[model samples]
Target: MGEEFLVNLKYSPDIPHSVDVIEAGGLTKYYGEFLAVDHISFRVKKGEIFGFLGPNGAGKTTTIRMLTGILKPSEGWVRIFGLDTGKDILRIKEDIGVVPEMANPYIDLTAMQNLFLVGRLYGMRKGEIRERGEELLHLFGIYDKKDKKVRSFSKGLRQRLSLAMALLPDPELLFLDEPTSGLDVMSARLIKRIIRDENKRGKTIFMSTHNMGDANELCNRIAIINHGKIIAIDTPEKIKSMSKGHTVIEVSFEPFKFKPGDFAYGEKIEIAGDKVRIHTRYPDDVIKEIVHYAEKNKLKIVSLTSRTPTLEEAFVHLVGDESE
Candidate 1:
């Protein structure tokens, strides 16, 4: 657990120079017969924050693991800065940094010790480690508690330490999986600002997240995955425009007794008294389904209206079935 606490961030990996920081070609993975990731291919240019988005079990994590060399792919190939991920994984990782999903710093050690452990593992001299580590601690606002045992730290503090450790080496390429998955509001904001700052400083970032707002704001381009495949890939503006302001339908059923499962047309369902507010992309289909359900149940239709989705309501809509 203590060893796993080592975090890394890079403005450059072991590669001295490269145009595309990451090149994945037909990356695929399987757990025996169950395919976790299909033939997904993409390129991440240098210095841009690329977002990976998907619903639960959509192969985002599997892809990241393959990119970072944590898990070997079942098929296909990947290159990091022109170096083959399958062959030169160690070299590719030498100067890069990663903050895995829910990554944690060593709770058993002090924050400074955790940093030192990670820095030494990266082959940094003590002086260099101290200089860079202290700077990151100060930058992350954890300088005041650098000597405190991380076991006593809050979740937010542990998260900040993880990022600090990752950036200790000043890497040029960074990979993060759900960097702000379960953080407090302030912590999340602070980490997001740091991520943007890193990218601004010419560091290439590959980040996977479930937060649509985060993806829309932090990523220059995004790829949405579903069912082990790349369903969509485009700039956030273009993607949001595709599903802009999801169709919202407000219907009042006379019976006022319908389970949420009774509707399949809506992505989200909420009920209050006689009203059911459904958020969906297919408003017309949902409306028809509501009418049909009411007729079949021998109930009267109180009222039905289609409401425009708010700008803030825009989120990437998954393709295909809604399982999981």
Candidate 2:
């Protein structure tokens, strides 16, 4: 594990047993008269991947800035590693890494140089910087381009380099804001894989993104925020279950001749050529009705499947309600 290769720091083992790795109480932020973040409270346990999910302008970045000591909260407090953010900003920064949204490395500097700069800023010795920088570059699949100036790199490569820089310190807590925001599939996949690998090594991660698929795959628990307020917070399964009572039935028929309205049991139905999606509270009732209709019309069922609401659906349901 990468943790084994990280520099050891003096940490007391006798810290309070109930201290969360990250905690916030009534955290709020404002810009003039406009509230950027409403009073919100949450805690991130040690070694857990906590996701902050919301649409753009949902105050996800604002909350992260305050927590990371880059911004002061208007009416609350945040503690990291049991140290108050306001009182121990420098001490807390040493143990944390942050990759802000669309962060860019020094364009004129080579990738290796960027890492070296970050390492020096953190007061790492020259030998330590070179060795660790090489490891991080290789891990992020950018070692081959380490000598190339960042200005010539593609967006995906730049993003990868940004992450590599963040990891240079081997931080215990990582704050990533939209890590995979705008990247090709391969690049996004690579970033997500690294996140999983890091989590396996017992690092706590706090990620903020609007990408539901990534949130579902990577997050242990997700908090949905909108309009500067958190609407829900729980495991993905529990959040999805909140949209219960509606089962989605996907069916394909050989004949492919069926109108959505023909299925009376469905609360909503969507038809696309040979495939039909039926949303209903009673899956059995809907399935029976479809089977009977198919049999009567001599339409053979090619395939059928049923699924509960997905996280995306739950998000839409929750955010949509809040918007109204």
Candidate 3:
């Protein structure tokens, strides 16, 4: 069994262990007089998924473009694999796969043809292209539609084909921007699964997304940006811990007859139908008060659950404060 497992394993020999695959220092960007990205410094270790998270127009795309060498940074620098992006763009690009936001495959070509074109652009040989393209199509679950014209495909199919094309060369690092944006449930899940599989194969992934679920599920470390500034950077658990002793308690009653203000123990309370969500720093005290209130009102508690703060909550807490 061990031998069989070893035989089936795939490895990326190019990525050095325990090294920074991407490094940025004081990275900034300006469009004319308006600042698009403020000074941001971060490092992405090899073989980990690093998430860049922010709302729309928060300089996420600008940071990605600069790191990919598509746009010049107005100040500071980024280095990939110890090579400066400005000076070694061609060399750096050879080992990186990029899936930009809303990227589309060639409409006039078939899915296989699109992969073939990408392979050719990377100077892959005929046999190499054929083998890798087919593998990528199968990996992305679009092999059966390989010969179908891209124009006839759905948005999800097009996005999958674009990702397949990006993976044709089996690059060491992948840069994905909102990879699941506008995708349906199944499509989004499939994309996320593929990302996890790629990370297991030792690929370094730098991803930018507004989807908090994706970041919480996949990222080893995340940087939260807002208004051109990165306000927080850490593991999801650590960032969520910034909620600082806050907890959310949700309760459902057999017969609803209470208003949010009637509790008078929570920092914030929200009522929806038969359910109530209470936020508080002292969960035990709040729970005791809730039990006392239920007994006094002769109400039966149907169910109750307590939850820690989520990535979305942490993000909103950080960015919302900045906005205010």
Clashes of each: 12, 0, 0
Task: Assess the local accuracy of residue 167 in candidate 1 as a C-alpha lDDT between 0 and 100.
Answer: 90
**After superposition, which runs of candidate 1 have C-alpha atoms over 4 Å from their true positions?**
1-16, 244-316, 320-324
Off by over 4 Å in 3: 1-18, 321-324
How high is the lDDT of residue 28 in model 1? 98
lDDT of each: 0.83, 0.88, 0.87
lDDT (10s digit) by residue, model 1, range 22-52: 9999999999999999999999987789999
Lowest summed lDDT across 10 adjacent residues in model 1 is found at: 1-10
Tens-digit per-residue lDDT, 160-230, candidate 3 = 98888888888889999889999999999999999999999888999999999999999999999998998
Model 2 per-residue lDDT tens digits across residues 136-242:
89988989999999999998899999988998988888999999999999999999999999889878899999999999999999999999999899999888877
Question: Which of 1 and 3 is ahead in TM-score?
Answer: 3
Candidate 2 local lDDT, residue 267: 72
Winner of 2 and 3 under TM-score: 2
Could you report the Cα RMSD, in angstroms, for every candidate shown? 8.4, 3.5, 3.8
Error of 1 at 286 (Å): 19
The number of the candidate with the highest lDDT is 2
- Candidate 1 vs candidate 2, lDDT winner: 2
TM-score for candidate 1, please give it.
0.75
Which window of 10 residues has the lowest lDDT sum in candidate 3? 9-18
